[model samples]
Target: MKINPKFFIGLGLLLIIGYFLQDLVLSDSQYIIGVKKKRQEKDDSFRRVNGSPLSQAQRDTFKNLPYYAPDRAYRLDAQYQGFTLRDTLRMATTGPQPEAYLRWGQATFILNKQEYKLTLYRRAFGTDTTLFIPFADRTNGLATYGGGRYLDAAVPAPDDTEITLDFNHAYNPYCAYNNSFVCPLPPAENRLNVEIPAGEKAFHE
Candidate 1:
């Protein structure tokens, strides 16, 4: 019996495609697992750890903080625009006094075919190497915290031109769980017109 050459070619192509599809599925599964593990650790801290934002009573009744399902789409690579002259931005908080932060840079990215930008900041008095991003979106006062959510990124080096912004890790401020804590509201420039459905949802809602 003669084996057709085309049959072997088609079989090889199917095997290659199957291998890639399997790899993609594994990658997605790992991402989702990692996100869930981090979320669970946070919940554990809130429930049993000291200095948690949750009150004793709240912690006793706490099950888990709500969050949107993990999605790769919400993670983006943004164009980083660093400032030559950093300016002080006194961000208003829930309390009377405002918190000071240095306007470090800007991150511009496109979502849903539209362009958006967010100003990044650093603590005015700390030696921290993290970039702070407090932002509000259309989800506020509906599915998520009304006061907004916060994201953190590693400070990009001066020559770095791109940074990753993962909305999946966005979290509610401490003030969202406790009224005594004063949390900085998202600056007006960081208020996005779009809805970000990822990250932690409202503690009360």
Candidate 2:
């Protein structure tokens, strides 16, 4: 009995496709795992470090930082709108001096049928691609810090126009734990009317 050569050729193609599919799935899974590991390491460092924002009393009894369950819904891909004339933004801090920030751009995203816009900022002398997003939501003064939380967005590339806003990575400013640290208050424009239940919660101290 002679086996058809075409049958073997088709089988070879199927095997190749399956192998690549498996590789792709594994690669994605690994990426998610890496994100989780990095987050855990950061939390661990904050809990164990002597110079962490956590108060000494909290650190003594701290096992882990309070955080909402990781929800992908809060992780959004924003449409970046560049500002033609960059304006200076005065941000109030916990201290006497008001920090000056440059308006980098605005990220507009829709969550739960509500359209929200957040102003992204960069330090006057900041040369890096990190955009600071200090925002307050309805959760403030309740579940999260009253001063608000912050999220950092890094441009994936120099020419990249889009960015990822991962609320799961939002953290409280150092002032939330220790008053010695001068934390910039979230500007009124960055305040969102919606409730963002994700990210770090309010500190008890």
Candidate 3:
């Protein structure tokens, strides 16, 4: 019995599509699992008696920190523009004292069809390789920490022009849990007009 050539062709195409669908699902599942594991570790740290950001009283009653569902959409690829002459930026904190940071660079990315830019900072002292981004969005005071959220990136090499900005990993500053911790406020420039609904949510609500 001879099968039609068209039948075999259609079957092969279906198999190929099935394989890609399976791979896509597996990739997404792995990403979500990784996000959850990191969040769990953070929650455990928050519950720790000695080093926790929570007050001793708060730690005693701590259960788990809240988080938004991990979403790949918030993981963005940005064009990075490094500054030739870095300037010192005194970032305001929740407390009266301000902290010093270097205005190291900027990241530009498109979200929801609108382009936005955020300034990245480095510690003023010593050679710090971390790019710190403290930002406020429309989600603040509603779904996330009212003070703002933070994202950290590796300082890209001078020639590197692109980097990933994963808002899925954005987190609340320690001050969100305890006011005693004086966290840096998101500078006016970093305050995004858009809503970022991914990552950690308000501790209270």
| Best model number under lDDT | 1
TM-score to true structure, per model: 0.95, 0.79, 0.93
Across 61-95, the per-residue lDDT of candidate 3 in tens digits comes to: 88898888999989999999999999999999999
The reply for model 3, stretches above 4 Å from the true place, is 1-4
Name the weakest run of 10 consecutive residues (lDDT summed) in model 2. Answer: 154-163
Write down the TM-score for model 2. Answer: 0.79
Q: Which model scores highest in TM-score?
A: 1
**lDDT digits (tens) for residues 1-205 of candidate 1:** 9999999999999999999999999999999999999999998889876879988889878999999999999999999999999999999999999999999999999999999999999999988779999999999999999999999999998899999999999999999999999999999999999999999999872
In model 1, the runs with Cα more than 4 Å from the true position are 1-4
Pairs of residues clashing in candidate 3 = none
TM-score of 3: 0.93
Rank ordering of all candidates by lDDT, starting from the highest: 1, 3, 2
lDDT against the true structure, per candidate, is 0.95, 0.85, 0.92
**Which of candidates 1 and 3 is the stronger one according to TM-score?**
1
Clashing residue pairs found in predicted model 2: none
Question: Can you write out model 2's per-residue Cα lDDT over 26-71, one digit (the tens) per residue?
Answer: 8767756765776788778878766678776777887766788767
